[model samples]
Target: MYRIAFGTSGWRGILCEDFTFENVKVVTQAIADHVTAIGERDKGLIVAYDTRFMGERFAKETARVLAGSGIKAYFCKRDTPTPVVSFEILRRGAAGAINFTASHNPPEYNGIKFSPSWGGPALPETTGDIERRANEMLGEVCYRELALDEAARSGLLEEIDPRRTYLAELEKKVDFAAIAGLGTVAVNALYGTGRGYLDEPLTAHKVSVRTMNMHRDPYFGGFPPEPSEKYIQDFINLVKGDPAIRLGIATDGDADRFGIIDEDGTFIEPNYIIALLLDYLVRVRKMTGAVARSVATSHLVDAVARKHGIEVIETPVGFKYIGELISQDRIIIGGEESAGLTIKGHVPEKDGILACFLVAEMVAREGMSVKRLLERLYGEVGTFVTKRENITLSPELEAGYAAKQHQAPGEFAGLKVRETVTVDGSKFILEDGSWLLFRKSGTEPVVRLYGEASSAERLAAVMAAGKAFILG
Candidate 1:
């Protein structure tokens, strides 16, 4: 039996390695035990899977184990995104949801994310319980399988329609009418599940939109399925080649995170996307509340919030922190450096599909291009050049960076280190209003270096210096 380790969000591993049918059964039973421990075992559970290889089959296997354990599992019958499952957990008032997806990981990998009944990602405390139960499972899933017809007759299992409920709930958050009015928009699913909903709103409202990669491919057709810069050039080129196309939106595998392209066909960083939307929502929509952002996110948001006389709260480098704040506080918006975001009174989980629609509506309603909107935001919040690079470190250096080792240099690239902070990792604040961060990727052996510079050259220089330190 392979030990299943949980990341900040969920449990993930390569499909054939740590992730297997036997292991999935073990984890799902553990999840059943977790729900049972909370006195909700017979109250029921929900299961959903994405379009990846064997995701649906994995979801069924999990249900089989859970049902066998006497914990009824509400299985999602169709391929769907992670957020849709999270929403179902809350809407149905079930114990929680277990999703079969790897999020933005490569196609070869798969993962399981446990969402609480509130339709939000599980907290560390709760996930700890599930992990403890998983470790003790040891491939011995003690549960009795009930036939599907028998289970339904016993008032237990039911298949769900994630798309129908998800679409209905979205009307309250997205300006579907305004987005549909935008004449021509280019969207590339990157063959991810983001295709169906995005094209629907536009088509329903008579908006002229062109699409690509709409067909499903389990392998993602040899691409990494991350929707990162290199993986999304096809969509960028589509937007650039067509003069009528205004914005380009792409979602990662499982469709929880989004990557964007402006009218100029340049990928807009997620940090900027969050800040830009925050600016639009608060300034135009008259929403009132504080802003929550991860520590790794750009301070341009802080600048905007300061101008608006609102407080800014910074948390560790995960959406859980932001989501926790949103659940407890009257937060107008919460965002992370990655493309996950949530708004006030909406589902606490991040919704990339919602964000994509809102961004297009923001542009259409104001009669401004995404590039122009970002430029205006820069003018108000000051310029920011964000760059990230990763490299493998020697074992010794790995430990140091993992512990946030600091090297005091008088100046780096003609800019002095003004101050240093280590909230979650090492972050150096430069005198020129730029910063550099060195942090270890939780799931990989590489050390990631991020820098926000005041100029393009300074950004490049910081990257070079960081690469040299990490690779050397």
Candidate 2:
């Protein structure tokens, strides 16, 4: 009887809770209903799931519900990334794609993300429509079971191989030869969906590629599968333990977010990666195009783009905005602070595999370590460090706190707040150039605080002042 609400990407919840088998069936029926109403029922639906709990069963239920509703459904044969399954939708020109992946959330969670026929994420307007349809069908799904033999004969159910199409797209967009030139690169995938995707590309490079933690254990080792600094600190330590491993690569669950550990074993932030890639693509590769990012992303990219006389487009927060910009021919590369990214001629979804190879290619072409590349990038622009912290608060308390931040803070750490932005959250930019942005996490019961400054001390101060505001 639970009405579904779409989060950042799609509907997600704790497995066996709001994400029960019953709810999935209802959601599938809603999707099928929407497609049928829009006159695309014959276009069919594609379904896939990750390695989360009961993911296979969830996908099967989704397909069964869709097929029961007289909508053709082609489900994935095995575990797959959201991006990979999304690729299959476009490859087969299906009506839509439904992927059972919570996408970097804690192991206790599982969810679905839908892709439209364009193969990009279902845009906000369409997602809103789906939500309406799903809520209407809530508790009304009494799915009819179709025998496998009958379903196959009806030509409404099939199993698909989801990898080949996405891999082919990767080969076209990424410069593989550049990455191959790196003599030795260590790849430690953060136990997410990027496991096999990284190997084939690197193996063809003939470079010494070493990988770890590729197993798709659904629990994610008792931690969230996010590719944040803390989540991938193991890879950071691994790189620090060995000087020969020049670059470390990782991906979040579902293989959309990317993590980069420098040669010095420092976890470089995604904002920095965005700026550096912008510089490399436009300045070095002579790729004449603009860069785009969410407003929460570092200003370093804006700084870099201005220096090169290129353009930088800023969105509110979601990759959907950035993806739309890419589709509209506004950007050549798009990345967010949270590590979601995409590029021109690529699927509108963030791709960890493509991001990994792009950075590796930059290192090989420049003949510099990620650490050194950052140094040079900083030398040209300026040095910056960013840190983020999450504070748990009840929804009621968070709503009250946000109401106060809407008008902005008067001061922080003896410096007057010169600017305030409510783009995604309340971002108080102090006159000293230190900044703090407080926003509620869309996926969890926590409020994320992001701070950036030129020094560690200032960054700490920013965090402290921001924490006081949030907790107060």
- TM-score of each candidate structure, all chains considered together: 0.94, 0.93
Encode model 2's per-residue lDDT on 147-177: one tens digit a residue: 5566778998888877877787788877788
Clashing residue pairs in all predictions, respectively, total 2, 0
1-472 in candidate 1: lDDT tens per residue?
4677888679988989888988887788788878887887766888887778898888877877777778788888777777677677777888888898888777888899988766678888888888888888776745456676776677667887778778888887888788876778887776777768778777877888888888788788788777677888888888888888888877777777888888878888888888888899998898999999877888888888987998999887867777777777578999988789888877777787878888898988988887788888888878887877777776777777633355546556777889887777777788888888777887667877788876798889977866665655
Quantify all predictions' global Cα lDDT against the true fold. 0.80, 0.80
Which residue runs of candidate 2 sit more than 4 Å off their true CA positions?
142-145, 394-399, 442-445
Candidate 2 lDDT score relative to the true structure: 0.80
